[model samples]
Target: MNNHVAPRAAGKQVFITGAAGGLGAAMARMFARHGAKVFLTDIDADAVTAVADEINRELSDTVAWAATQDVRDEAAWIERLDQAAKAMGGLSVLVNNAGIGSLGSVEQIELKEWRRVMSINVESILLGCKHALPYLREAQPASIVNISSLAAFKVDPDYAAYNTSKAAVAMLTKSVAMDCTRQKIDVRCNSVHPAFVRTGIVAPFYDALGEEEATRKLTRGIPMRRLGEPDDVAYAVLYLASDESRYVTAAELVVDGGACAI
Candidate 1:
């Protein structure tokens, strides 16, 4: 199935973080198919390169480049952005989507794990915005789509660390948006909060619950009556990254299937 959408990307360049996993890889391919030069990075070296190779193989001139780097490293952000910009010819989009998840009540979660979750979830977005802003400003009329979570808005036991991290992400997007406007950077920043998606984070848990339980019980809580797919979030990213959302910033687009509405 081809996931490309022409006129949506308009051949702009997009740099995506966490480009190896389900949602990240899907977004990379979708943007490439839409005629954008896509550059991606992940801590998983092999996975990042694999996606880049696949995209380059399919879309030769589209320019797909990947790097292995930790999102928490501030210096690495500049290095990767420079590399990606050099490879893709320019930088027009930044998707601050690299994050890790955890499931534990506040008291039960270890200090190390809590810190790690926050570092990956919150620090990554901050660093991505900090390092990518100058380039985005130069590119002019660029967009940034940050990945938050429904946990930021809803109650979920055993997810205190994750929830807190995402809450920070939500506000970070708004803060960046304000900074852009105040500084007249000509860049738009937005955040997306999605409910349970069928990604690695929840797949194993669903499997342990069996198909019937997974679908009938876990997903029954979702107003949409189903778990969100990576593509569901990818499309949201595409919209925010495109000129279609040019005037839209400092906004949070909850792609949680109305889970937060209830």
Candidate 2:
């Protein structure tokens, strides 16, 4: 990586799942901009390749490489991590950001949908940590940032599967952090809970309400009076990934614009 800031991440290696999409791609650019070698992967191979290519072109650092892997597959997680370790030279950060969104009540959503969401949202984080633990232990001073949601802490009747999965993520992060501490591993694990981010998953939902109506309705519960942007959560992820949050672990960083604050 080149043109790096004079800060901690100047030479670090970071691996981000869901690299083909919104938050994941933003994270890749943010870390690369700060001089980190980023390994990118997603189920959508072409999209991830474009993201990596764009990052390399924009930064002239040649710091990103893309791979195709389904996060729901545990064996694929191991393969991807090993590949990322080789590509980035070593793995120092892992962002478990790949997840799906679903909208339905418990009675409304099919069992298959619930299972799929759990497999991707909650199970993938577990697999990522399980497979990457050895590499993180070896590297020492590593970080795992799992992308959870504000719905994890709130009751969203329309999105039971998503809410349940994110809730599991919160506890999963804590469990991983505790195990790392007990095992004498110099690793930090935390979950980020973002609310109503204006990403693809939420855009269509908002589109039905229209921009003005959606803005008013969504912010009604949030004291911050706005929906979060991808960069908003990206900054939080960067903080947790960097040494600045070295003393912070097993914590839930709520990036919900104070929605749950009230």
Candidate 3:
């Protein structure tokens, strides 16, 4: 990606889930900085509202609206998208970034918790695509950036639910892309797999371990010898969301600091 700023996404309309803090907020800022009008959504209404306020103030050149929804709710998806469309005039990009982490083995995880994780992490993707694809088709040459984790390609005994959920996200990205091709839609779908980024999403992992231990564990196998920045993933998202990735679809963009390569 270019280091200097240019309005690559000028006049675009973007709707992002989990847009309160961490990577979601980072991507929202990046999109706005690139000149797209953004709609920020999160289950945490106050946090998302604060996020929208911050973005509006910080990036006065672009526009943003805020909404809150449980991503797992199909009705919420429809209603939120309707409001987002009206707020932004149209929808051009959808970022399925809302998700939660689960830290337990299958035997250790309760069935209800497993279902809850699945609902938030996986079902939400289905709901987003189902509700957004129609409007996305109307706004052709649009993009969907699904935030799958590098855990999808990895495994840990204590993270079965999260691993499974993210793995579903990875495959669903491809399926959505192929289906769009079949229907001859110009919308592209892709997933990003970020490993050990220093974001609130990884806070639980850090808290489970102390700061020093958590840092060591998270960065243990990565070649870069450090955790990733939110901007690292956000830049990749910006590229995917912009017209620059027009030819790219049904792909996994790994921002793992070369850990996957190892």
Candidate 4:
């Protein structure tokens, strides 16, 4: 993790979903370290609270708060955003980072699984962007960073549902961005597409094939020859959530280490 602290996000109030672990946890830490007040949420109540406590302990300040949330629930989105905005004075950044991965080819995948993937990965983003707009607008110069995936661009036969959901995220981000711009809202919307990173989401690969072999297999196509660290993607998100990318909206920031270049 980067130790250098910068006030890039000072005074920014950020709400992040799926912040119990992996990329979401990394993002929460990154934002808090840089002076942003973060409200972290996840379905995992215990884990999410632990993460918040850890961040506060590290910073020795009350810059992070924790809550349990089911991103798929529209009611939860409405209530949580309100609570967060009230707690932090206002909501300046919404990181739609809650998502899930699926396996099975098109014909082999079950309808229920497909629906599950769509609801959590795609619909949740819609709910978040739609409901958070008011708070974000009130806190002008806000940003919505949707965490997409390199899978949206690169296909895998067994990842039918996962691929489709992420692709939807990419386009949905653009739609939201355009709407906000046309209406002269100061909220910026963008997507971050990160390739495989060393996170809990990819733990299955490591468990099946030893870490060394899994690393080799996963990095074979990446030019960097290594799986990306959570901070790698977290940094990209920080840039978009901060004032640095004020003019950058409706853009796809790819952090795949040249995977898409091939």
| Model with the higher lDDT, candidate 3 or 4 | 4
Worst 10 residues of 1 by lDDT: 1-10
The number of the candidate with the highest TM-score is 4
> For residues 209-230, what per-residue lDDT tens digits would candidate 2 score against the true structure?
8888888887888998999999
What would you estimate as the lDDT of candidate 3?
Answer: 0.92
Among all candidates shown, the one with the greatest lDDT: 4
- Which of the two, 2 or 3, has more lDDT? 3
For each candidate, what is the lDDT?
0.89, 0.90, 0.92, 0.96
When superposed on Cα atoms, how far off is each prediction in RMSD?
2.1, 1.9, 2.1, 1.8
Best-to-worst ranking by TM-score: 4, 2, 1, 3
lDDT of 1 by residue, 145-173 (tens): 99998889886778999989999999999
2 or 4, which is superior by lDDT? 4
Give the Cα-based TM-score of candidate 3 against the true structure: 0.94
lDDT of 1: 0.89
Clashes of each: 0, 0, 0, 0
lDDT against true structure, model 4: 0.96
TM-score of candidate 1 against the unseen true structure: 0.95
lDDT of 1 at 28: 93
